[model samples]
Target chain A: MKSLTKNDLTLLVAVAFLTLFAPFILNPFPEGSAMAQFNAGYPDLMQRFVIFGIFAIGFNILFGLTGYLSFGHAAFLGVGSYAAVWMFKLLSMNVIPAIILSVIVAGLFSLLIGFVSLRRSGIYFSILTLAFAQMMFALAYSVLTPITGGETGLQLALDDPRILGSSQTPEGNIPVPGLFGMEMRDSFDLELGSWVFTFNIGYYFCALVLIASFYLAIRIFRSPFGMMLRAVKSNQQRMNYTGLNTRPYTLAAFVISGMYAGLAGGLMASMDPLAGAERMQWTASGEVVLMTILGGAGTLIGPVLGAGFIKYFENIFSKINATILHEWFAFLPDGLEDFIVAILYPFIGKGWHLTLGILFMMVVIFLPGGLVEGGQRIRSWLQARKSKNGRPNGTTEPAE
Target chain B: MDAIILQILNGLDKGSAYALIALGLTLIFGTLGVVNFAHGALFMIGAFCAVTLSRILTLSHTVIDETKTDFLGNPLKVDVPYVHDIFGIAAGNAIIDWAVPLAILFAIPVMILVGVVMERGLIKHFYKRPHADQILVTFGLAIVLQEVIKYFYGANPIPTPAPAAFKGSFDFGAAIGFDPNLIIYPYWRIIYFLFATLIIGGVFAFLQFTTFGMVVRAGMADRETVGLLGINIDKRFTIMFGIAAAVAGLAGVMYTPINSPNYHMGMDFLVLSFVVVVVGGMGSLPGAVLAGFLLGVLESFASMREVIDIIPGINQIIIYLVAIIILLTRPRGLMGRKGVMED
Candidate 1:
């Protein structure tokens, strides 16, 4: 294997640092402060950030690298969740066997769907994957009630057999998901005057897994296989004419992405211990697509950034209501404050989707390369300006 | 046998909706060469037009009728619709009863306008972009449209009943020498089927018979050659988009009475309709219509109690299952032509 470039190593280090201290970085405001409401360091939200980040990274391997816009990755994610939960029910509370089982099951399911869907390209592939996912969703919601738990979703019961460990904890409670005897839900809080920060075991576990997934993704992106996937995206016709079979390359990418989704799903189940049929829906698939595109599809950090951005927005926006808006606008005149709240009301709270939709449209229209590209453009422009300003004192050549 | 006939009737009614929506989808795809993900939103808007019209008709003002007393011994205020004042109470009530049919007239112009604006404003810019870009933008638009509808309608299904005249079910089995309630079908569903047929026929005839249609067909086949021939094909395509929108809108307007118009109703139909379009063969109009009915009937049949007893969960996923099989085997769908998104 080829060694990582200096740039690649630097990027990996930066990502590792950011993810390692996310609890501190994400919670910039003090707990008692007004700005604390904007903080996203809570265990649940933090878990989602890394989990969805993993999901998007996997999705990026397929869609960003291979240009296969699968609208059914959620099916694999849901399958992973179900598999993990079942593993817990059948085996033990340890997340290792459950996560491993999830990846294997989701990989198998994706292989089957990909083998069929990969025969077609473009819109047809999208539709095919979508159809398969919908079929899974329908079955989960209705017919596969025994395995999937129907509308209520699959949950652990006290009667489940755990050959490796006790079914019930020493405290006479249903055993929580954990590694060996170490519980996932246990958290320690650090307080400093008005500031408080929580360190959760489950969040750290998810963060480590996300870092591993991210490292694997970076390896895949830099590998020869990644180049072949990109080649498939660029020109399938040319590759075929060159006597190179693109199907296996694409199928591998699809399976890899599917496993990533399964891992994310497993982590989610390890956190919550439930898997709903809605997790397999097309809209959920669309959300992953949105996250990938919004951050920048082909770029390494884009999917993770997009996932974090969307999850953060979903959490923050949904928490704001009319009362919050009123409080925010209270400094204005009496009539004007009420008027401002009324006007701003619909775009927040339950209307967050509207704001999200409009933002998505604007991004697609104006920033096709997404927020990453926008950042690059801004950085380049600023560099250009700085170079022009220093041209008199130095060489007149343009900065690279 | 009667039960089978009833199921078939149910299938046809459902198929009519699928066929209608798919027809508009195909029209847009054929002429504009764009895959419209927001076409379902147009159907939703059409349904809301009826809801809006009925609301308008029943707009009322409070009148203090001292003859009536409240439970608190205060004079009761009676609200009388303005329509009741202009046209007597019975006539106004009758007019409100026929709000849905009246919505057809109201929806055509509004749907066309909406379609034209959507095409000119957003879709026009996306014509030369990649299909992925077009799909994403249209999907975004669909979400925006849905959220807007939800904001106005409060996310609940608002029931819009059929007129009193078409409220009852007709005993078709009795007329055909079977027991009286054996093959009974709703009068509105029959009307809807007939209406869909008329619109489908009208669209086909418009494309097949008219000179404008001939030009549009030529443009669909080869745009550069038609442009070389000095025709303003873009404007005509825009009109065709409006027509397609009207068709979808009319379908939604009629469908309101079948299932209540909800904000997410468009999304509910969107995936299924796309499946119908794909199974129908991408840009093939007749294929879209044929596959729509075919899949719709298959869906109804799969939902039968006996079928469910055997297959267990076939009812929920029959359409998608059929789609996957057809896509894998047929590839180009049931009636797809050469060189239309074949890659």
Candidate 2:
């Protein structure tokens, strides 16, 4: 409820570290065991978790803090991605320069969009943002082909001038930019008995950046600036009557969030070495909104959890086929097995979206504050039962 | 001059689709005040209705001819539909040829039922929630609907052809004393334009002439006052939602020949239609249609080779760019009424 204490922060950091090194932690599991799937050690997905976490965290600063639900934040992310990719193509392969340039470009872009969109509050703001995002998407898909690469998307080639890194052979070899020859996919695998423990160097790099971003978010949340943003959310007219300009504060939040998106975009290109216009599509933007709301928008840990949950489901649900469903239902009677499979059929493959839709509706209908509020409700209910039995639980009610 | 006229004609056909879709969107938003993101999906289902009808009409049973071995030295097989015998060749051919037109009859009830179910089951509950919640739920519903269609139809564009009579181009240039090739436009596209005009006109006339429509319009202006007059405004609005869905569905059904139906086709148009609504001024019905046509025409113009060479992706973004300019300058849109979401 209260701001996290130093000890609490330390404990959270330790848990995060453990989660990052989960493959090593799960080294006790036999090779190809079902438990091995639980390992959050893959570089590609781990980078996604952190990158999207950054995105959702930035979004929360605006929507979670100010109660402004933006339907078009993906525009900024796309802008950031394009800028980062441009940096990769034109300047150097070094991520530091690319990320810096991306943040600045995205920040400027957001500043312009936010300035116009923020003129209207509530639903109008949402529509305006959506309009701008769509405009950007359409432009990228068609007119901006020279820059955005249209539908097929922009890719790095062997001929791209790597001013800061060693050049690879121009014949069918394209290199992913790295920090001083440290490849993004480079990983160390340790064999422990029958299990394989993998530690990706890229994962650690992403984790370090995520930690720094998290710390920055914490500082922002705890700052006076955050209080003003909350005030704007609560009552902008009152804030205006109080002789305070709320525009700058809202714009600042928007810009900061945009920069965070840029950082995420830069990291994405660093890991994958490509940028596509599809990344900027309104749906991609909507995904982050879902992640933020699902995780418990406004809460620091909620977006991360939401990101992990969605990504995990995306992976697991896509892997499930009709055969897999049949195998799972093999224990039942022949008639019942087919019946159950039929019922479960719509929740797998392309039907995975049906599951997500039902889940989203359930969350919105029941858990408005998302998983964080759901967690708090459970904790309080348990505490209430304990107190009724004359055992006072030390945990207090959560702050809004 | 001929090229310009042809382009204008082309623009009119494209504009008609945008106008119809945006009109439906605005109707729901104006009256119910719920942004129906699934409207596009309803449009898609309408197209799929034509696809379904075509497939049904073509349904056949295969027969093997043991004596008719050919190139592969295997038995030749023939496929035949039961309808081929029952209806005979002429009637069967007519049915197959007219599948798309006949689909309009089937699409109406289906889309209206979908609309009613959507309104009563989901959107009815969301009346008091924030617009964000409405957007999210509707978005989720859209995804669910699209995915369901994709699951059944697979993720490919299914071509639904126009009727044989409407297959060729109309020679407008010859009628106007110009070269025959200069102003040729597809007969189907002309039919689409006429269809859209009729639907739009019929919708306006119904609202203006019928007592029920008048009451519904009154409710759109003020629901509480209409309710105080002892009318069931909610039921009327629900009906209005159905009408809106039907309109969108009709648009989708007619649009099949122009562009093949895909699982994600609705989404491609949804954003653009929303932009049309905004540019027309939010919650304004006429504004939506006007903006839709205007932007659609502008988009067509932007797609000209010379114009495209100058501005590149201008055609793709022309509508959105126009929307931004209109929103910034007019704020309430070209004909936006005061106090309608201005707050």
* Pairs of residues at least 3 apart in sequence or in different chains that clash in candidate 1: none
Interface RMSD of 2: 1.7
For the predicted complex of model 1, DockQ is 0.88
Report the lDDT tens digits of candidate 1 across residue range A1-400. 1487887788778778888898889889998787889999889999999999999999999999999999999999999999999999989899999999999999999999999999999999999999999999999999899999999999988878888877887777889999877799999988878777888999999999988888888899999999999999898999999998899999999999999999999999999999999999999999999999999999999999999999999999888999888888999999999999999998998999999999999999999999999999999999888987978555556878
CA RMSD of all predictions: 2.0, 3.7
Chain B structural similarity as TM-score, candidate 1: 0.97
| lDDT accuracy of residue A79 in candidate 1 | 99
Question: Candidate 1: lDDT over CA atoms?
Answer: 0.93
Q: Chain B alone: TM-score in each candidate?
A: 0.97, 0.95
Query: What's the lDDT for all of these models?
Result: 0.93, 0.83
Worst 10 residues of 2 chain B by lDDT: B311-320
Instruction: Write out fnat for all predictions, comma-separated.
Output: 0.87, 0.63
Q: Clashes per prediction?
A: 0, 1
Error of 1 at A298 (Å): 0.9
After best superposition, candidate 2 residue A76: deviation in angstroms?
A: 2.6
Candidate 2's residue-wise lDDT over A1-400, tens digit each?
2577785487368647755665565355677865554455556666677788788888888888888888888888888888878777777676778788878988998899999988877766777788888888888887778888888888776677767654564455766666776877788888768777777776677777777777787778778998888888889889999998888899899888888888888778777777887888789888998888888888877787787778767765766778878877799999999999898888887678778877877787778888889999999998788887885655667889
